[model samples]
Structures are given as structure tokens and as C-alpha cells.
Target: MNIVHILKKYPVVILLLLLTACEEDGDKIYLSGLEASEFILTETDILLSKENASKIVLSAAWKNNTLVVSNPDMGAPDVFTAYLQISTQEDFSSNVIETEGTGESKAYTGAELNAIARNLGLVPDVATPVYFRLRGSIGANMESAYSGVKTVYISPYLIDMTVGFILDKDKQQTGLTLASPDADGIYTGFVGATSWYNFFMEEGDGKIWGNLAADGSAFLASSEEGSWNFWYPEPGGCYYTEVNTVRKRWSAIYLPALEVSGDITGEMTFDRPNTRWYYVFNAASAGTATIRFSGQGDEYNYETGDGAPAAGKVTIAFAQENGQLVLTGAAGTISVQVPAAGECTLILDLSDPKNWTCEVTSGSEEPEPVAPEVYVIGIDDGITGGGWNFDNKLYLYNEDNLAYAGVLNVHSLWGYQIGTEKDNWGDVYTQAGGDAYSGTLEFKGQNNLAAPAPGVYLFDVSLKNLTYALTAVGDHVYVNGLDDKWEFNQTLAATSVPGVYSGSITVSGASSYGFKIYLVQNNWNMLFGGSDGKLTYGGADIPDSNSWSAGTYTITVDLVNRTYTIQ
Candidate 1:
């Protein structure tokens, strides 16, 4: 046949034969020693600043060190895909950032790195190290080994952070400034002269401050009486305060201070029912004398007139003479003289106005210090198992040295206070200084107390001196039930209410499951199980009859009641 005629008639057949041969030869080709070579970073170690971060670029060369062998009649694969991995951990267990494409090199912007660093828990002005590695893949299931890791040092740009306390939520006062965060990013402050203060955080030169909502925005105050109730921050909680750099405004995260109600001193009985009550306060010095009253109802309602007396309620008036205070009111005149210049409290017996008497005390003496027989109530933060609930009454037993002691497991950055009675905000005790580890304690108008870290502690409180000491202790509780597969972490916490522990769990399956509670998750010590609907300490496992059905329930174990209930 002629060449031109044959080519036209069998062109398709010839092409198929050539392709088939190539496929067979290509199938025989194999690559060995496939590995991604160590990356060539632009900078092995970097100290990133805000200014430099914007201008910096993270570039790395990704290379494959694999040996490709092919039949003489075949050729190597045309393209290879490469990937770069960056992480804060050496093992890349978490916080891993990846960049991949079909190229020999990869580049990341400074902004991208900054975001990654933040996710790694890196704070501004703190030097943190990050790791990087490269890998290559040719097909699904065929990937090169990771290359040697490289390190990058980075320090984020910092925004100014400030904290303050607003004494009254109803009225805006020039908030008391708090000490700046130390090297560890911890803020310290003292709160006195106010029953309860709302804490706030601000950024950017500390000029503007606002409230933070759950979604991290400015919280608007309502016009109602308790409109700002929801804005009250929780003590011992860590929150992120959002900032608007352009406007120099900060949406601060609010944290509540530990509140303690100081003791009430002097006993006064009235013989007649009168519409008003009065007390004369004498101060050692006369610098805008301020007198505080602790009784019932709203704090503002208990106060009357700047210098005039009010009928049917409690009232006090002060006039200065030679740096001393002479208080005059409907209850008559009282003189206050003390060695040191300070304020004093006068207990007025108005129940019988005709035969009323005044019991005076200096500022150094707490109105009603904790007494030996007084019931000592604990402060409940969520971590303690009370879930920030104060309804439960957990009283501390009296120990030696006029002290009441209890064991508590504290969560990191959490705060709490002590009180003499249940549901009484007028007699609470708070830390005297910002440092709870070593600080004097005061009652009623004081800041919340917090532990620097999380752990178990032995709280020793003395009502006589209005002081407290916390010593580390070792005591824990655990739950082992069908819901948890008889595992730990189903912990039962002590609530503010004494002798009761509460927790929630999800039970699976339709059948009943019996379990037991223990002092420790893995330990068998102090085992408690249901015995005829009652709790038996160090007893047997709860019988199958008491097994719970499939559902989510809150379990309350009452030691005082010697019973357990699933709700």
C-alpha cells in the first residue's frame, strides 16, 4: 500500500498501539527514597514586632529528595505537589497551620503568622517559638516523609490594657484605677468603701471603657432598676476585652469582685415603733466625713439626707470642729475621739426612742467580727461545685484559735468570699489586699478574694481579727457511674451549702445502671452508695434497683441528709 493511503486509513489504530505501549512501560516505573528535604527558611529565628510583623514574610523552599527510576522507554511523572506545616508544638499535636500548592516554595504573610501565634496562646510582648516542616505528595496514599523541623521566634505587638472598678452600678463614678498587669499578665487592685463593685477592662491608653457581652461586644445598660444586673461579671473568670483602635475605645470584660458582709456590732432594742431612726457619727478627722450603714433592703434606701435627719428610717449627720467630728441628730449628740484619725460606727437603739442608747466603735474594730458560735458560710464559685449558687448553706466548723476551717478546691483565676449567715450580703468577708496569699481580711465592703492558681486548699478563717489563711490541702471527689463508663472526670463538687455535692451527667442506654461515688476518681476510698434510698459512706455499690434510666440528670448527694437524689 502507498504510505499516504495507509496513514489515512490506519491512523487511529497506530495511535492506540503507541499509547498502550507507553502505559505498560510507565506502570513499571517506580520512585524510591521519597522524602521532603529540610526547608530553606528566610529566617531561622525571628523576633517579631508589630512593625516588623507587617513587613515580614515567612518563606520556605520545599524539595523532594526521592530518586525516580523509569524504563528507558518511559518518562518521570510531570508534576509533584508540596505542602508546608507550621505549628506551636514540636509534635504538631494541635494548633497546626498548613499551606499547600504545586510549587517548590511557600510563603506566609506576617498577618497570617500573627493570627496563628494568637491561636497558640501567645500573648503580645511575649516571645514564643513556632515550628515548621515540609512534605510532598505524588498521589493519594503516596506522600513523602516530613522534613526536618525549623523554628521561628515571634513576639506579638501589644495593646495597652487597663482595669478599673465602678463602685456603684446605678451611678457612674470615676472608677478607681487598678495596677497594670505584671509580666505574667496579672492585674491587682484593692476595693474598699463600697459594698459591691463591678470590674472592667479597657485597652488603648485606658481612656474609654465599656462592658463586654458574651459575644464580645459593648453591653448596653438598660433604664430599668436592675437593668445592669446581667452586666455583673463573675469573679475568677478570664475574659477577652474587645478593642476599637480607631476610636480608642475598649469593650471591657467584666469580672465581679469577691464580696463580704462585715459584722454588725452593738445590740439596740427599741421600746416604741417610730417611723425614723438616727445615729450620730463622730470622726477623728474632718475630711468630708463618710458614714456607712449595714442593715437591710437596698443600700441607698438606708441612707438619708446629706446633713439633715430623716424620719422613719436610719439617718446620721456630721459637723467638723478642729479636725474632729461632732455628730448631731434626732437621737441627740455623740462625740467621737480616737488616737488615730479615722471614722467610727455608732449603733443606735431606736426601738425605744425614749430610752435609746448608742454603742460606739472605732474604725479599727469590725462592727460584728466573726464569733466563736457564729455560723461560718463559704463563698461559692462555679468551680467549687456550687455553680455560683449561694442558696446552699455550707457552714465551716469551728477549729482552734477562734478560726473556722474548711477544705476547698479552687479553680484558676476564680474568687470567693465568706459570710456569717446564708443569703446575707451585709456580713461577708473579702481580702484586704489584691493578693489573697498574704493579705489582711475585711468584712462587708471589700474586694473578692482569689487564688493565683488552681488547686486544693485549707481555708483557715479567724473572725476575731478579721483575717484568713489558706493552706494547700489534698482532697478530691469523683463519680463512677454507667454514664461515664465507670471513669473519672464525672466529679462531684462541694457547694456553698454544706454537706452537699452536686453535678450533672448524661446516662446512656435504656436499661438501668448502678454505680458508686468515691472520694477520688480512681481510688476506692470513701465509697458511698445508695442504701435503701440513703447514702452509706464507704459502703457497697448502689443496687441495680436504684440504677438510673437513660437521660440527663442533676445528681445531688447530701451528706447531712444521708441521701442521694437524681433530678
Candidate 2:
């Protein structure tokens, strides 16, 4: 065969014969000239950063002669495996990192190089020299050959300190975590506690951090393992907490409630994620008055800004002092103009702790009041009284409740109308056509309200919610505390009025004339007494004051209006 064809047919065998022709041991195999060759590096100096973590930072390559097997007659073997060893020591005596592959060159990314550098005890952001060497191994039983060491200067960056777990004083995880999106070492989140509690923060690297001072004077933190835990001084509520590892400082703002006091007064709802407190302010009349923001055990007075209480939106200006959002001026001195008779929304935004602001914008106004005269008009259907007459009149017995109730004998397929005026068809209320007896009430619709079934129902209408309901009426109620007996003995019969019950009871043996009303016999779940001189569900006692005198009295219980009276 020609030289080219012979070399191609048994290239490994010819190369081994030419390199190790004088060797005699049949099983011996080795790589020649590996120790004498230099290990080449693409970059002798590199600066590593988290921003370029995935980018290729360094590359290493070395040349080694082909494997030489003593017996040319043996089967030819595949390419040898190359290993890249990295170490901080010049002699590579300890802490060596080894990586293997079937190639002559190896490349590393910034993150991989940074990790290796950190593993070698190199300080972050500091440039240090590391040693690299290449080795080649032919087979499992064969000896390996290594190349000379190459030094490279590398600067590593700190890993992400963004995620940390909030642990209780017992060092147990609380399932609450804080994150620094920017990875700037500042973590923020809200925590709720039932009482005074102490907590600690454990970083993603399993390093626990706590307050530097044992007493937690200013909420400063330390990385020491034995540091004291951060604590809440006040009792039981929600708080906005922030921790800055860079500055070793921390702060917790107690936010039990946010309220607006003075001319524009109302409670504000908390928008936790946005760190905002907002409430709709209604202007009864146009005037100028000094208004203040209160809650968090302090008052926030107005400083300087044109965004005062006006007809449109106005943003109030604020500043930060000592890491807390504070009002510029003294309390009760910041006078603002109130908008004309209209509604306005007031907002206090502390989303940015350094810059706090208040904004006033247009808001919804209170709705018009509904007239108290509401009557049920429909065909009698034999069970009800007058035919096509407004005889079943619903009464708003309780002004505070703002609902009308009355009993009506309804037919399964019958339709009804709730009218404002007696015998007036023009002023009536109808709903969307349906058999859903309990639903919203429409001022005027294409169809009348359909009855759910044929039965005596306690019909109820809520003026505030613009809704209606039809509940089956119970026949009677159980009365207790009569004649000083705790057990129920007297019963009040339900009247034609939806929830009204009347009965005559003699309180002769009772030391005090007190009683409780219950819907179910021997059941306290649906019970009622008196609260603030009105019948209340699950209230303390009848008469509220518990000072009723013994006598024979006619008792009237208005369950719908939540009121009771003894005549």
C-alpha cells in the first residue's frame, strides 16, 4: 500500500510504532512530551462581574504527543482524555479543582471562573493569581502525563445576596421571605404578628444575620452568628419592615390604621404593595380649614405644595428625615382650601420612603335617599287580601336598618310590583324577568318580579343596597327568662307583619324582668337580646341595661327592624 493509504488504514498503529519502537513491555502505554509542553491561556488577566456571568472569560489549551502503545499489533485506541486542573497554590499542592473532557482546549464562563476563584479562598472584587495545568490520560490503567503550570490573574464578584428568609427567634423558618430585586442588599416586606416578637434573617448562603446590639436599640444588624434577633417593640399589628445589609441598618413602621382627621375625615384603606393609604373625602361645603393625617401614633401635617383639597386632583408635597416620611410643618397650622360641595379622594403614598406624597382627586358622591313609602301591589290569588290592590304594605320600621319588610301570600307563577305611591301604576319598581325571588331590585324594567313558589314569604327590600329577598316565614319564636326560669316556656306568635311577634307574659316570680328571644328552641345560635335600647342579634340582655321591673306586659318583637318593646 502507498504511504497515504497505509497511514489512513492504521494511523494509530504507525504513529505508536514510530514514537515508541524501542519499548519492549507489551502492556505499557504512555503520552510523550506532555510535561515539556507549555499550557497556553487565552487571557492571563480577567475581571469577572455578575453582569457578564454567562460570557466566556478564559480559555486554556495545551499540546501533547499521541499515545504510544509498546505492542504495535494491539488494537488502536481512541483519543486520550484531557483534564484541566486549577489551584491557588503555585505548586498545586492543595485545593486543586479538576475538570475532564475529550479535547485539547477548555473554556470557562465568568460565573464558572468566579465560582472557582471563590472556592480557592479569593476575596471578592480583589484580583488574585491562580495556577492552571493540563494532563492527558490514555486508558483507565495507564499512567497520566501533565503539563507545566500557567498563572492567570482573576477578579471575582460577590454572589447574589438578594434572597433571605425571615426566621422567628427560635431560628425556625416562618415561610416569609424578603427579596432585593436590584440585588443591592436592601430587603423589604410586611410582617404581621399577634404580639411582640423577635426575628432573624438568613441569607441565601445560609448565613444568619441579626441585630448588632443585644437590646436592638436602633435596629442595626450584624453578620455574627451569635448576634441578637431583631424585635418589634409594640404589641400586635402589621408593620412595614426594611433591612439594609450594606449599611447594617433596619427600620420597622407600625401601620395599625391610617385615618384622616379634621375637615376631611375618614378611615383610609391600606394598599400594602403600593404602600398607600387612601379614603374618599366628601366636601359638605366650600371652605378653608386645616386638615391633618393621623395614625401610626403620630400626626402628619401639610408642608408645602399646591395640591391642596380642590375641585380636581392635588398632590401634597412631603419630605424624608432620618429615614422616615414626615410632614414639613407643625400640626394644626397647615390650612388648605376645601373644594365646593362635591366628593374628593385623599391619598397618602409612602411607597418611596425618601419621598412621601399626598394626592386629592375626584371621587364618587353619596347616592340619593329612597322614599320610605314602599307598597306591595299584585293580584290577591285568594291567599292574599285585596285583588290588584296595594294592601300588603311594607314598612321601614327601623330607620337605622333602612329596609322594608312585610308578609305576602305569593303564587308560584304570579308576578308582583313594588310601588312607591298607593294605587299609582306610574311610580313602580320592577326587575328583570326571572323566577329568582331573592335578587336585586330595578327602578323600572321590562318585566315584573316573578315569584319563586306558592307560599307565605317574608318579603324584604333594602333601600341602601337596592336589593330584595323573599324568606319563608317561621310561625313563632321561643321566649326565655320569663318568671326567673332559664328554660323557654312562653311563645310569641308571628303576626301578619313580616317579622313581628306579639305575646302576653306575666313576670310575677322573676326578680328582674329580663328576657332573650331565640329563633330555634333551646338553640343559642340564633338568639337576640337588647343593645343600645334596640333588639340586637346575640346581644347582651333585654333592655340593654338589665334593669326591667316585674309586671304583666305585652311584648312586641320586631325581628326585621331589630327592635323590642314591652307595653
Clash number for candidate 1: 25
Worst 10 contiguous positions by lDDT, candidate 1: 13-22
Per-residue lDDT of candidate 1, residues 477-532 (tens digit): 56686543666767777776555678877767433336777654466434566556
RMSD of 1: 24.6
Q: Supply the TM-score for candidate 1.
A: 0.24
Residue-wise C-alpha lDDT for candidate 2, range 146-203, written one tens digit per residue: 6677888988887556766788777777666666767687887555543335789876
Residue 5 lDDT in model 2?
17
What's the CA error at residue 290 for candidate 1, in Å?
A: 23
In model 2, residue pairs whose N, Cα or C atoms come closer than 3 Å (at least 3 residues apart or on different chains), thus clashing, are none
Q: Highest TM-score, which number? A: 2
Q: Runs in model 2 with CA error above 4 Å?
A: 1-290, 293-375, 379-414, 419-443, 451-456, 460-468, 480-490, 494-500, 504-541, 549-554, 558-564
